[model samples]
Target: MRDINVSTEAHILEAAFAVFSQNPGASLADVAKHAGVGRATLHRHFAGRDDLIVALTLTAAQELDEAVETATAHCQTYTHALEVALGAILPLAARHMFLATEPAINDPRVAEVYASQTRDLTHDIDMAKAEGAFDPHVPTEWIVQAYDNLIYAGWAMVAAGDATPKQAAALAWRTLTQGTGNDAPSARNPWHPH
Candidate 1:
């Protein structure tokens, strides 16, 4: 009986991700249809849409925590860890990206998780800066924001079928380390006056 409850809940969450990722405005009925569960069963697992969103947000946060830990576990440098984390996280975009602008994220529980994630990533960025992997002159907060936005961009590329997750991750890494500029000495910034 417990197993069945857990299975149904998991199925509903999975369907929520699928339906919500494609359309943030999708209703609980859409999730029920996608999961092949009756509306009653869906409501039994989650009282309402906000409840479901919170569940999904918490689930995504837990998954991200695990991915970051596993990805960085064997890394010798924070930079490499960041790259590896990007690889691990890009595939989870469907589970998380939709929540970026969702009001449910303002829930205290979700905010706490997000705060912890920010602190962890900030520490990693500081460590990478110490290793000269990142510019010490730049604000750590800015770097953190850039890193997060890059992840979003990479995920968008993958979601749009413009690139595979691997390709998107590599592009994100390069964009982080190297701006979109010609490296040749003769190449000059057109916007800058000499």
Candidate 2:
């Protein structure tokens, strides 16, 4: 019985994310309709938009972490690993359209999630550096900041309706790689720097 209730709650939150992505300002009633749940039931669980949004953000963070995990699973090199991780996040971006609007939020959870992702990205930057994937001319901090900015820029472009999520993602890939990718793969391969 507890498991069933938990399942239903999870489904409702997924539905909430789907609805909120389409309508960032949607109310609980709106999410209830999307979740196919009564308003009372939705409130019994989520209670409010802030709760729902925080859950959605955390879901996204989990997805990103999983992406990194999968990417690093067979990873022999950091550059290849980061690329794989980015590939994993592609689907997340396509589905979680709410991320386009959430960066503008002043909520502490918003900042909290941002900081968490920053830490993860910095870890990747460090790995990439150790693997000799970064431009020697760039500071690791600058590379990390660029990666974070790229995420926001992709979301911003989607928010402005200048591009679709697919396009923003492609541009993000290009921007991040161009900004941080090693200028000469021959200069050094940390795995085999002779």
Candidate 3:
């Protein structure tokens, strides 16, 4: 079996995330600094932005899977599990608003990671649909569309104004449900669906 170590993988992602967060256009040199590795070392592990993005994307997928696993570990109802899993991603989604846009900041490789993250998100969207967390008639395509629309809308709100992170999360939640929150949420609750 392939040797998989969460700590090491997380380290790599942390480095990549920091760079992407700081400057979506961050160069490998930037990521190397964040990761505390040499350029050669970074290259040894990831050949380029495309490669690094793919690796980062895979890491994102795995961590999200783990988040769901963690949320679902207690053997509780699916709502409990879904909430836990969603919670993990909510924070990240709330925090990484910029990276979602302008993927070619320092490395166009970011697009790869972006794609990976969306794929994992699609999985959760499926789960939510299956469990009726979403409206029974909520099409998977609509969920995908909602994700794209809401992410940009939410991120713009956070970046443009003095909006707090809590406000950002709430905006994302409300918009995802209704895709119609031009302003911040009326209530600062992430779980309150439209």
TM-score of each predicted structure versus truth: 0.85, 0.76, 0.57
Q: Tell how far residue 119 is off in model 1, in angstroms.
A: 0.3
Q: What are the clashing pairs of model 2? A: none
Sort all candidates by lDDT, best to worst. Answer: 1, 2, 3
Candidate with maximal lDDT: 1
- Write the residue-wise lDDT of candidate 1 on 76-184 in tens digits: 9987898899889888876677887676766899889988899989998888878777655566787788888999898888878898888988998888766422342
Question: Per-residue alpha-carbon lDDT of model 2 for 1-194, expressed as tens digits?
Answer: 89988988888878877877677788889888888889889878875766777777777777777766976799877777766665565556545657656652466866777787778778878878878777765677888877666766766676667877667767877888775678746455454467
- Relative to the true structure, candidate 3 reaches a TM of 0.57
Better of 1 and 3 by TM-score: 1
- Predicted structure 1, TM vs. truth: 0.85
> All candidates' lDDT scores?
0.83, 0.72, 0.60
Residue 174 CA displacement from its true place in model 2, Å: 3.1
Best by TM-score: 1
Kindly indicate the candidate among 1 and 2 with the higher TM-score.
1
